[model samples]
Target: MTAKPMTAAGASRASVLFPAVAAFAIGFGLIFMSGLVQAETLHDAAHDVRHATGFPCH
Candidate 1:
């Protein structure tokens, strides 16, 4: 049996809020509870290098 997909036609305004709240909860948990990203990723390192006072890499 196939599971039915959800859609906006059946969703209320508060349903949209659920995803935003879930995202915030995940971000908050990762930053505060897990400490998972304190070590810089490549993107973070590159971003820092880009912002280092001399040039706008735009």
Candidate 2:
């Protein structure tokens, strides 16, 4: 059986798709890891940033 070469459109789609998939995977992994942390710990870490952004934590 002969193998088909990738067309320009397919190559372009793959290039865009790979980075998007990689980014989604990385983001999901980070959220999953953060979920394992205690709520208070996460709150403490983001406390300063929240206040800086004028977000009320109280």
Candidate 3:
């Protein structure tokens, strides 16, 4: 069987929107939660993310 070609019509709004919304929610949640905690706690949590994203933090 032959493979079908991809088209713009095959892309749904939810496919793109879901990731954006999820990321926004995660960021908002992190920010909100951090405010409720201490600096050391936030730093530890963000440290993992920074390394994962290849961001340098000292």
Each model's lDDT comes to 0.56, 0.68, 0.66
Clash-forming residue pairs, model 3: none
C-alpha root-mean-square deviation, each candidate? 9.4, 5.6, 7.8
Judging by TM-score, tell me the better candidate of 1 and 2. 2
Which stretch of 10 consecutive residues in model 2 shows the poorest summed lDDT? 30-39
1-58: candidate 2 lDDT, tens digit per residue? 8966878666667588989999999998775444434468776886666557665553
Quote the positional error of residue 32 for candidate 2 in Å. 0.2
Top candidate when judged by TM-score against the true structure: 2
Better of 2 and 3 by TM-score: 2
Give TM per candidate.
0.33, 0.40, 0.37
Model 1 whole-model lDDT (C-alpha atoms): 0.56
* Cand. 3 TM to true fold: 0.37
* Colliding pairs, model 2: none
lDDT of 1 by residue, 1-58 (tens): 8966668576666877898899999889754422333434633545555456433433
